[model samples]
Target chain A: MSRAALLVLADGRFPAGGHAHSGGAEPAVAEGRIRDADSLAAFCRGRLHTAGFTAAALVAAAPHGLDPLALDEAADARTPSPALRATARKLGRQMMRAARATWPGPDLDALARARPRGAHQPVVLGLTARSAGLGPEDAAHCVAYETVSGPATAVVRLLSLDPFHATAVLARLAPELDRVAEQAAEAARQQIDALPAASAPLLDITAEAHAAWPVRLFAS
Target chain B: MSVHARARLRAEPDGRGSTALPVLESAGPLALRRTRSPRPPYARVTVVGAMSAPLNGDRLAIEAEVAAGARLTVDAAAATVALPGPRPDADPSTYTVNLTVGEGAALHWLPEQLVSAHGSRLHQTTRVQLAATARLLLREEQILGRHGEPTGALTTRLTVHRAGRPLLDQQLTYGPDAPAGWDGPAVLAGHRAVGQLLLADPSFEDAPLPARLLGPTAALTPLAGPAVLVTAVAADARLLRGILDDAMRELLDGLKA
Candidate 1:
């Protein structure tokens, strides 16, 4: 359990193809729902507690020697929007590629063969964490942080707000982020059925709308 | 006061090839009535509330099954409201619905909106199981609060399984005690109404609908299985239904094609 491994996996430059997504920020920006730091904080907070929380639980549950395939199905069940599902799998495949290159394990090989298309990103991240010798809480923190970091970074590029303010937004959310990760990890210890199924209907709706956009800055 | 209610219904093909309700039992506050069906071979049933139900600590359950080759439609007469009980410290009311559609059978569940009134708490769960060849259409709508009122705590979970495989499972929370920022821009964005329509047909396996937006806030997307989900949110229930109705019309037309 190297703490440095946690830092590496949590890095925004991990090449997981997350750079292509705005985490629903693109559409919110188009709708003027997210204008500056204050609105961005609200949006990020909502996403972190709902979609982000669910994903972190999956990330935490992915290890523990659980079946990745079943976790993938659970991920599918948790994700109602088809566009977001596709985006998750695409990101999953990219993450798998990066993880295998860095860790090189048979577990990754077996999962890749099982899901030729790709598993869910959080599940893949969990497996990547296992191969990296990181714990479940570590995996949970990675996703919980990524959940807000991706949006904050995207907003910086999308709105051209002060980068300092954007970073400050993440800094302010640190306490809530820790709380979400802890709860997610705790829930992951239970039966998969008992895991959190929190959702954001507006996010699901907007992601579909974003996918259908004739012109857009993000893939979803 | 708290009450426990149960309703069970079974729709099957009759000797005349029309759908028959061989079993229809209503108890407590849940009243089930068979209504005339404009389309032959499809039995339609409407649920009428006999009293103000789902009060705090109440447990209500409805179970419906569609036998093979049968078609059924279940609807409600009016919006169901959640209100607090007499006690100052009351438990949240619970409503559980279980539905099953057999092979080659069809079930349409189009219940009215569920309104969460002030100072009430409700937890509703709906689960549906479909045979590999079954077709289903289900709709769920939630209005946070009545006119000029703040909302109570409300949580709803919808889970669907097709041929013993998970299709969709999601839980939504609103009002007090929900996660922080639920009404923020990323979740409801201050909207008071939210709803979704799920349509699953074997035909979708061969020809899936292309994902697209139906309105400013609603979009239709194909599920991994042979299903399509349309989600929408609006300032009020009427606008929410309008968006869903339009999407439903277009999707039903697609099924016909």
Candidate 2:
């Protein structure tokens, strides 16, 4: 497997349509809960351990020859908020398009045909990783990193905080991020039912609220 | 003392447009009492705890089934408080609940809040299965602590399946042993009470509710299926219940129409 492919896949500008969503950072900012780097770090940490861990597990399981459709169902099960589900599929479709262009394969083609509308982003990420000769751990790391990086980036734009400070927050989270990804990869080896179901109810609640915002910087 | 208990209840439709309970069994601390229903065609049953339950190492199970065309409502007399077991080091208690609704049946499972007191450890799982035409209204509330005290470790999982397809599955953890930052800005945000109301009705398939926020800390969203889920968090159980009760009224009114 080309290690460089991991960098390309994990790039923030991967054309995955993630830029449209704030990963719940927008709602927290509006509520005045995230005013600076410290609060943002706390928010990202809570997110990483809960929903982030769950997403990482899904991505990790996706590349191990697991059925994409079953993984899609599992993703839906883990996602209780309709708005988040819509956001995931939107990002998934965009990722699928980019992956098909970068590394086309029969597996990617079949899944794209099956979920013409879109699959969950993590499910597609796993498949995209597979098509690109990446493994489950690679997929897990990509998603785990994105889970916090997306929010950090959005908070920078929303709060007008220093980009360096945001980057520092992420750097500080590297250890926990690694831990979550490692655990997620291990959980992925178990039965689909045994996959982590950790949830952040506030994220689900705020995503629903964010979806209704007539004018917002982010889609979710 | 560690104990294993089970409660089984079944509601069937009578020929005269009413519901009848043909099976009702209670064992150990699970006391199932039949009660009067404010509305006709719906049987009401209240669960009363005969003893302190869900202590460490306790295994408790409650199973309820609503047959075709039947309507049943199950409620609890008081909140179920989780207390530490007698031994300082004891295994966490487990409570399992399974509910099923048949074709055209309706089940309203509205119980009191579950309080996880200090020094307690509990794991609870609730699963619901619904037929294509069934209607279900389920409410769940959790209070982290009694009052001004640190919460005990509590984990709860709720899974719902409609017509052989997953509708919702989520696991929530709280208290000392929970992951760090659980009470941070993006999660509970220092709220001691958390709850959700799930309403699954075929009528919603035609006119789904537009997703919106109920108040500052709550939101109502349409699910993938013909259902709506309302989630809220408040400073106390009373306030949490009030928020959910309001949402319940709104959703039930929408369902009736």
Candidate 3:
């Protein structure tokens, strides 16, 4: 079960449409905020600390045997940007489709149907993890890994970095991964009802600007 | 009331008289309320209840206590145009607004577009205080001049504080007199109009935005740490519309990120 779950969650082709997003790496690159492998790694680390931490914690804290539909609503209420919300729902819908094909559960189906016009990805992920009988700590680890790995992997694809070097970046992020998972576990235990929130205006501004560009590599 | 110096009106509310909320004299607790219909293609807003306020001669100092669930859509009867102060005045006309939202409360402060006429100088500041569970949505638009007219000089400072810590701090200075200031590639890029929209919620993770939404005319750059900064130039009204559309889409896209 552990091996299968890892394979499914870590696979780059999970159909979440994450491949289409550089996690802000493209604009960061265009603006010269990330130039080389080291800078890219550094950027991933920052994301892990901020947005990544919040997401992992929320996943870990999913109520025991919680309803997936409730989780999706929680996540939707938490998100503010219309574009980001759409992207999350797209990703969530894709991930749900893939997970259902592999795991196949009544809960997953019910959760998908319950989502509002637009549901967020993280909420669906947490529901999937819980339904699979995964522990909170493991669920937290998966969330953190995907949050950091999405961008790190995107950077490699965008910059054409060596595959081996990209693996090394992941290796270096292990400690951070552990730390974030541990923190998420603690937050889950506390069972805080609030969503993980960060006030990032510039990101919203850039994402808006990026959407209007005539040409782009990622879906945002 | 001591008439120490002449007061220049930076921006007057849509009506002729003062708003229903009384303007206070001292720094004690104050209340302010504002309501307006939604301008087309935007959301409606209404601000009600007690707020903090103080009087400074002809100028009014205002602070707002935004209760939980209160909504405010700031609209103008017309574009807010800043005119130059009378002669012998060194300080520019200014307005300072401070807002606070209680736990579980939501505040949407969407104001109409701003137009700065030539020879007009104005300084404006807006600060918001958010509780742990508070939600805030704010939008602002600034146009430098009417078509065919040279852009005027304008200075603006915006700060947001959450749970007693500063979350966002931004300052912009422009106009012909500040030649080196407005022309900088990072500042205005010679654009006559600019807009900003901010929404902060503590319950969700930061959404991931696509790179294509940022326009080519402006530079959409990320700052140190977690913040991202986007700046661009708009040569005319059409360009400004494009910029606003892109910005609004992105701000609402937070759900997908």
lDDT of 3 by residue, B79-143 (tens): 45665544434446565667787676555565556666776666667777877667676666678
DockQ list for all candidates: 0.82, 0.74, 0.03
Taking all chains together, each candidate's TM-score versus the true structure is 0.97, 0.97, 0.52
In model 1 chain B, which range of ten residues has the least summed lDDT?
A: B212-221
CAPRI quality of model 2: medium
lDDT at A114, model 2: 98
Candidate 3 local accuracy as lDDT?
0.57
lDDT of 2 by residue, B1-257 (tens): 79999899999998899999999999788899999899998999999999988888889999999998999999999899998979878888889999999999999999999999999999999999999999999999999988998999999999898998888888889888887778998789889999989999988888888888888889887887788888899999999999999999988887776
B206 Cα displacement, candidate 1 (Å): 0.5
Question: Which digits, one per residue and each the tens of the lDDT, describe model 1 over residues A1-220?
Answer: 9999898889888888888889999999999999999999999999999999999999999777778898899899888788899999999999999999998798899999999889999999999999999988889999999999888999999999899999999999999999999999899998777778899988998898788779888888
TM-score between model 2 and native: 0.97
Clash pairs, candidate 2, are none
Give lDDT tens digits, candidate 2, residues A102-199: 99999889999999999999999999998899988888999989999999999999999999999999999999988999999999999776788888
What root-mean-square deviation over C-alphas does model 3 reach?
Answer: 13.2
Residue B210, candidate 1: C-alpha displacement in angstroms? 0.6
After TM-score superposition, the amount by which residue B243's alpha carbon in candidate 2 deviates from its true location, in angstroms, is 0.9
Question: What is candidate 1's CA lDDT for residue A49?
Answer: 94
- Measured with C-alpha atoms, the lDDT of residue B104 in candidate 1 is 95
